[model samples]
Structures are given as C-alpha cells and as structure tokens.
Target: MTTGLLIVQILNGLQFGILLFLVAAGLTLVFGVMDFINLAHGVQYMLGAYLAVTFVGLTGSFVLGLVLALAAALVFGLALEFLVFRHLYERDHLDQVLATFGLILLLNQGVKMIWGAAPLSVPLPAFLTGNVALMDGILYPTYRFALIGSGLAVGALLWFIVEKTRTGMLLRAGASNAPMVSALGVDIRKLFMIVFAFGTMLAGFAGAMAAPILSVEPGMGDTVLILAFVVIVIGGIGSIRGAFVAALIVGLVDTLGRSFMNDLLRLFMSAPSARATGAALSSMLIYLLMAVVLFVRPEGLLPARGRT
Candidate 1:
C-alpha cells in the first residue's frame, strides 16, 4: 500500500478502536462491579441506532436527534435494569445468561416489527459532509475525524471520572469487594443502577455515532457486541485502562491484518492460495491473540487493581 493508504487505514483502525472502547467500557464495569452477565447489552446499542433514525426523522437535525436518542436509550436501559436485571444480580450465571438471551430475542424481534427487516440510514450533517486534507495529497472524511475526536474526548472524560472522583473510588471498591463497600455504608444498589444506566448510554452513543458509516440494521449490534466481549477479555474484565489499551490493539491488529495479509502471503505463495489463506488467518488473528494472551497472562495484560 502507498503511504496515504496506510495512513488512512491506521486512522480507520483508531476510529474503530475508539468505538469499541465506548461499548466495552460500560460492559466491563457492569460485569466487574455488579457481577452481572448481561447478554442483552448489544440490544441497547441497536436501540440507540433505531431511536436516532426515528428522532432525526421527526426533528430534521442530527445533533438534536442524537441528544434525544441518547436520553431515550438511558431511560430504556434504566427500565430494563428495574424490570429485569436488578432481580438477577444474585442469580446463577446460567439464569442470567438465559434471561438476557431471551431479552436479545425479544428486542431484536421488536425492532424488526417496528422498523421492518430492512436496513436504515442516517444522513450526515451539512457541516460534516466533506473531507479535509490531512497532508499535501492525503484527505480524510470530516465526519470520521469528528468521530475520532469525540470518542477520544469521551474516553478522556471517563478516565478522569474513574481515576479521580469519589464515585470512581466507590466503583473500584465495589468491583474489588461489594460486601465490604456496603458494610462501609455505601448504597451499593443505587451505585449499580448508575453504572448500568451510564453504560447503556455509552453503548447507545457508539451505535448512534456509527449509524452514518455502517448499516443501521436490527442485527448490526451483534457483531459489535462480540467484539466488545473480545476487548474486555483481552483488556482484563474490570479494567478501563486495560480496555482502552486493548481496544486500540485489537482494532489496529484486525484492520492492518485484513489490509495486508494477502499481499504479505503472495510474497511466498501462489496468488489465489495466498488470498484464500490470508482471509482465513486475518479473521482468526484477534482470537489467536486472545488465546496467546490467556496462555501467557490469564488475568489479562492490565488486570483491575483490586481484582483477585
């Protein structure tokens, strides 16, 4: 690839990583602090995209639609927490998985019924509709640059909140030892609700942001959800810092692998065979990385500070 092409791919990988971080950040917290296995979290992402489409159609403004959709996503997530998730906190893992899996089916079907089984699109705002020159001859999409900036800003804000605030301290404490935190007079239940609701908003934000670039369809969140799981596993389940670092690693590895694997393989094998083999290996690269990580550092590269 040329230098410009390589630069574009690197930026793409960074943008992809940022989105994954947004989704995985909330998921890791919910799993780590609350000890809840929420398989339906991806549905929250799907709901965000759907809600954005609906609201944007009604308002005719991308910004307004995003705000409204995020709010709606938050409320919907809180409702799920109150109605379904709150009750499952102390249940067996099998039960949690089954219940949330049912939720995935219900919501996915519900979206299809309401929006039909077709993919949807969200238009870019006028101000962000074109590309900007990054170098003498290199240009990149304005909206994508904005997406990267936004994700980074949010990541920084999250880091500040988790690393420097009282709520964050409690969150860390809860993740390390919920019973002890409760014994110290913290309202553990309320904290958990806050975490879940916030995480829901983050996932929704990721979905809404991605709607313009990717197909906004019923099952779009499924693939992203699986990737988010991979991110957490590689980052260490409870560590935001780990999630951020690992997300970028996975994104760069996946994107770069796909872009160059065939070319690299062709250097040593027949073109046709190289293409086929490269495709297979590229897809498996991230999983192979995960297996290697688990074998080498089972607790993950940057495990949560207080986790055993």
Candidate 2:
C-alpha cells in the first residue's frame, strides 16, 4: 500500500478500536464486577443503532436522536436488570448465559419486526459529510476523525472515573473481591445495577455513533460483540486500562492485517497461494494474539489489581 493509503487504513483501525473499547469497557465491567455472563450484550448495541435511527428519523436531528437513544437505552437496560438480569446475578453462569441468550433472540426478532429485515441508514450531519486534508495529498473522512476524537475523549473520561473517583475504587475493589467489598457494607447490588446501566449506555452510544458508517441492521452487533470479548480477554477481565490497550492493539492488528497481509505474504509465496493464506491468517490474527497472551499471562496482560 502507498503511504497515504497506509495512513488512512491506520486511521480506520483506530476508529474501529475506539468503538470496540466503548463496547468492551462495559462488557468487562459487567463480567468482572457482577460475575454475570450476559450473551445479550450484543443486542444492546444493536438496540442503540435502531433507536438512533428511529429517533433521528422522528426528530430530524442527529444530536437529539443520540440523546433520546441513550436515555432509552439506559432505561431499557435498567428495566432488564430489574425484570431479568437481577434474577440471574445469583444464579449459575449457565443460567445467566441461557437467559441472556434468550434475550438476544427476542431482541433480534423484535428489531426485525419493528424496523423490518432490511438494512437501514442514517444520514451524516451535513458538516461531517465530507473529507479533510490530512497531509499534502492524503485526506480522511471528517466523520471518522470525529469518531476517533470522541472515542479518545470518552477513554480519557473513563480513565478519570476509574482512577480518580470513589466509585471507581469500589469498582476495582468489587472486581477483585466482591465478598470483601460487600462485607465492608457497600451495596453490591446497587453497584451492579449502576454498572449495568452505564455499560448499556456506552454500548448504545457506540451503536449510535457507528450507525452512520455501518449498516444498521439486525445482528450487526454480533461481530462486534465477539471482538469485544476478545478485547476483554487480551486486556485482562475487569481492567479498563487493559481493555483500552488491547482494543487499540487488536484494531490495528486486524485492520492492518486485512489490508496488507496478502502483500506481505506475497514476498514469500506465489500470488494465488499468498492471497489465500493471507486472507486466512488475517482472519485469525486476533485469535492468535489472544492465544499468545493467554499462554504468557493467562490472567490477561493487565489483570485487575488484587484479582486472584
């Protein structure tokens, strides 16, 4: 790839990573703090996109739609927590998985029934519709740059929350030892509810942000959910810092690999063989990285402090 092309691809990867971090951050927290295996998390992301599209169409304003979608997502998440997830918290992991999986099916079908089975699209705000000059000849999409900036801002905010706030301390402590935290008189249930709602909002926000770029359709969150899981695994469950680092790493590796793997492989193999091998290897890159990380530090690269 040319230098400019490479730069663009890198930027795309970073944007993708940012979205992944947003999704994974919540997933890790929910898993680590609550010890709840929620397979329906992906559907929450899908709900965000659907809500964004629906609200935007109704309001004729992207910003307003975003606000409404986030609020709705938070409310819906809290409701789910009360009606469903709250019951699963004290149950077996298998029960949690099964319950959440049922949610996935119900939500997916509901989306299709409400929005139709066809893909939907959201218009970019006029100002963000074009591209901006990155260098002498290179240009990047304004929306993507916005995504990267927003993601970074969110990441910084998250860092501050986890590192500087009392709630963050509780989160870390809860992840490390929930029983001990509960023993200290902290309302563990309240904490879980808050985390669950916040995580849902984050995932929804990610979906809203991504709606303009990716197809707004059923099951769109499935692929992203898998990536988020890989991110948490590599980052170390319950470690926001690890999720951030691993997310960027996975994004770069996956994006760059898909873009240039064939070219790199061509140096050592015939054209057809290289193309085929590159495609296969690129697809497996993140999983391979996960395996390597597990082999070296099974707990994760930056495991939460005090986690046994």
Which 10-residue span in candidate 1 carries the lowest summed lDDT?
214-223
Q: TM-score for all predictions?
A: 0.98, 0.98
Off by over 4 Å in 1: none
Return the lDDT, model 1, position 59. Answer: 96
Local accuracy of candidate 1 as per-residue lDDT tens digits, 159-273: 9988899999999999999999999999999999989998999999999998888888998878888888899999999899999999999999999999999999999999999
What are the lDDT scores of the predictions, listed in order?
A: 0.93, 0.92
In terms of lDDT, model 2 sits at 0.92
Write down the worst ten-residue block by lDDT for model 2: 121-130
Tell me, by TM-score, which candidate is best.
1
At residue 197, what lDDT does model 2 achieve? 90
